[model samples]
Target: MARTRLLFACLALATPLVPATATAAPLPASGLVLSVRQEMGTFSTTQLSCEPAGGLHKNAKEACAGLAPVEGDFTKMSPGDAMCTMELNPTKATLRGKWRGKKVDFQEVFSNPCVMHVNTGKVFEF
Candidate 1:
């Protein structure tokens, strides 16, 4: 009788209060996965780790394809009307697009697994 009660209690406690799948969507872009995101005067990229593909130098080309970014003007236009483009190679990542007739460039790092880093005017390591 005691074993049965304990088992039932354990099962009740194990029940999930909320569904596990209710979390936000995973970041669309990943290492070497080139993605574009734009807002007002700035465009940014999703930082991805290149470790899973056997390191950056070896798999840089393949990883670059997974990087995804979203582009749009938050105040002026819809997402479809914005223009954003990225060029990433084994060496650097470059972003170019027009926001309300102004140019915006954004960059980020994918090299280390410690933390995400972003910069402008230079190609970052992945």
Candidate 2:
């Protein structure tokens, strides 16, 4: 009984040292923030809200339509047929925010803006 009591005392002390866990809040139903940065330090960003399809994006409806087919998987987006020069301008693309209640965070670097546009299509054309 003395050994059991000692173990219980040790556990009681250790419990206070354990770190508390934090739960992340659930993501919004449908929205995304898209951006692109160029090697020259120029960048642009825009908000995109789907479902009803509206935001600061120039063509939110078209962008959302393209995303729907891929279910928000940017990597799986069909590449467009736009021809691009081989110049290495170094453009970085990013996408973050929620889509259909799912969280999304994506980033990629391309040779140039043309390549980024061809790869991402209307979703990042804002």
Candidate 3:
């Protein structure tokens, strides 16, 4: 009788931890927060939300359009038609957040700000 009572108590304690439904919580449509850091240590950040295209980014609409072709895959972005110098002023860009309800994390380093812009276009233009 004591073992049965203990088992019931343990089961009661563990029940709440289980989800009532199999479906997970819904995710936001699309969003991403990005940052860029120069070799000199200065950095800038911006937020981008797609679909309706609104955020703190100065070129949110263009950025969203740039991301659309690549489906938010930064590495697949087409290089812009910009002539960059061979200057080696390293810069790092990072993004973290969600895209189309899926989590995303990305990072990359470029030879310079100009190169960064050439590679990522408006997505990192902030």
The C-alpha lDDT values of all candidates are 0.30, 0.76, 0.77
Regions of candidate 1 where Cα sits further than 4 Å from its true position:
1-69, 72-91, 112-126
lDDT of 3 by residue, 5-124 (tens): 643553343222337676675433777877788996676776777876777789999998998888888878989798999998899988767778788888999999999999998899
Per-model TM values vs. the true structure: 0.18, 0.74, 0.76
List, in order, the clash count of every candidate structure.
14, 0, 0
Give the TM-score comparing model 2 with the true structure, all chains together: 0.74
Looking at model 3, the pairs that clash are none
Tens digits of lDDT, candidate 2, 86-124: 998999987777778788888888899999889888888
Clashing pairs in 2: none
Q: What is the lDDT of residue 45 in candidate 1?
A: 36
The alpha-carbon RMSD values of the candidates against the true structure, listed in the order shown, are 20.0, 15.4, 13.6
Query: Which regions of candidate 2 deviate over 4 angstroms?
Result: 1-28
Error of 1 at 30 (Å): 24
